[model samples]
Target chain A: DVKVTQSSRYLVKRTGEKVFLECVQDMDHENMFWYRQDPGLGLRLIYFSYDVKMKEKGDIPEGYSVSREKKERFSLILESASTNQTSMYLCASRRAVETQYFGPGTRLLVL
Target chain B: DQQVKQNSPSLSVQEGRISILNCDYTNSMFDYFLWYKKYPAEGPTFLISISSIKDKNEDGRFTVFLNKSAKHLSLHIVPSQPGDSAVYFCAASALMGAQKLVFGQGTRLTINP
Candidate 1:
């Protein structure tokens, strides 16, 4: 079975602090994605990478950035944490044009 | 505007009954549709999918129906169990090579015994 693991399941950070959320997939998939899910608004894509060192901004990429240094790991970085950024963050991996497998989400809270 | 829409916010059904969740899309270019189920504190899981070429696809207790003319699709779970209660999201992808799925707002389903 394919497994996608996030570094933290729950996190709390202070305002103005830098935050890092890590995701790793054992499937060796070529595509990785980061999305933030909010109530009523649903899931909005933040960033996606098709290959190592390659990234693309999604619809809502402001205040967020991503790093894909290796084939199996992808990281989402919050330059400066704020209260507005608190939400559930999800990481997913997929092969070209194939179904995406998601990891257990990380719930982030900024105080 | 919203490309994919799930108008219903929530639905409640009795256990052992059928639960039908609906989804509609305005983008005519969408060729592939999929449904995902998510539990609280967990990521969404792929449930079933259908291509434009077929009207229906079934897997065990879950079945997906697609209507190209109406640009609508539905997920049917027969004999719905308590475990089947979750939030259902509908998504569509236009191109085959790069599956950039546009998802709906999602519908929360509750099963009552």
Candidate 2:
């Protein structure tokens, strides 16, 4: 089974603080994605990486950025955490055109 | 703009009954559709998927029906169990999108014992 692990299950940060959410996959999948889930809004993609050092902005990438320095790890960076950024963050990893496996998710609370 | 839509925000069903969840898409280019289940504070998990070529796909108690002409699909769960209660998100991807999925707002399902 593919296993995707996130850095934290819950995170808290103050306003204007930088936040980092890490994700690692054991299956060596080349594709990884980050999404923030909100009530009545579903899951919106923040960013995705197709390969090492390759990244692309998704539909809702406004206040988020991502880094993929290695094939097994993907990182999401919050430049300046705001209250609006408080939400459940999920990480998913997949092979080309395959089903995406997701981590447990991290609930971020920016105060 | 909101390519995928799950109109029903919530549904309640009695155990041992059938639960039908519907999804619609505005983009005709979508060739792959998927269903995912998510629990509170957890990431969405892949439930089932269907390709445009097939009208129906079934696994265990879950069946996915696709209607290409209407650009719609539905997920049917038979003998619904309390554990089946979760938020279900419908997602779609165009063949050339490289698996970038557009997801609906999701439907929260509840099963009564």
Candidate 3:
């Protein structure tokens, strides 16, 4: 079975504070993704990394950045968190076009 | 523009009754379709999927039917159980390799006793 783990299950941060969310996968998948889920928006992709040091912006990537320094780990960074950034964050990893395995999401609260 | 759409925001059904969820896509390039089920505060899980070449696929109590000409797909759950209640999302992918799925706003399904 594939396992994807996130650094935190819940987090709280003040406005303008820097935040980092980490994800690690044990399947050695080359593709990793970050997504935010909202009530009416479903799951929108924030950023994705196809390989180490290779990143691509998804539909909504304005306030977020991702790091893939290693194959097993992917990190999402909020340069300066805002209240609007409060939401559930999900991390997924897959091999090429196969089914993606997701980690239990991190619910971030930016106050 | 929303390429993938789930018109119904929510659906309610009695336990042991059949539950049908619908999805539509506007992009012709989409050749792969998938359905995911998400619980509150958890990541979405892969439910069922159908390739464009095939019109239907079934797994236990769950069945997926695809209508290529209409660019639509539907999921049918037989004898719906309370545990089946969750948010269902429809997703599409155009590329076969290195695919990035485009998802629709999910439909929340509830099973009433």
TM-score of each: 0.97, 0.98, 0.98
Q: What TM-score quantifies how close candidate 1 is to the native fold? A: 0.97
Flag clash pairs in model 2: none
Model 2 lDDT tens row, B1-111? 899999999999999999999999999889988999999988889999999989999999999999998988999999899999999999998767667888999999999
Lowest lDDT sum, 10 consecutive residues, model 2 chain A, at A93-102
DockQ, cand. 2: 0.83
- Provide the lDDT at A19 for model 2: 98
Tens digit of per-residue lDDT, candidate 1, span B3-109: 99999999999999999999999999899888999999999999988989999999999999999999999999998999999999998887654566788989999
Query: Where does model 1 exceed 4 Å of error?
Result: none
DockQ of candidate 3, scored on C-alphas against the true complex (2 decimals): 0.81
| Deviation (Å) of B99 in candidate 2 | 2.1
lDDT of 3: 0.93
The digit string of per-residue lDDT tens for model 2 on A1-111 reads 779999999998999999999999999888899998999999899999999999999988988889999999999999999999999999998887778889999999999
Instruction: Tell me the tens digit of each residue's lDDT in model 1 across A1-111.
Output: 989999999999999999999999999899999988898877788999999999998879999999999999999999999999999999999887678888999999999
Pairs that clash in candidate 1: none
Give the better candidate number (1 or 2) by TM-score. Answer: 2
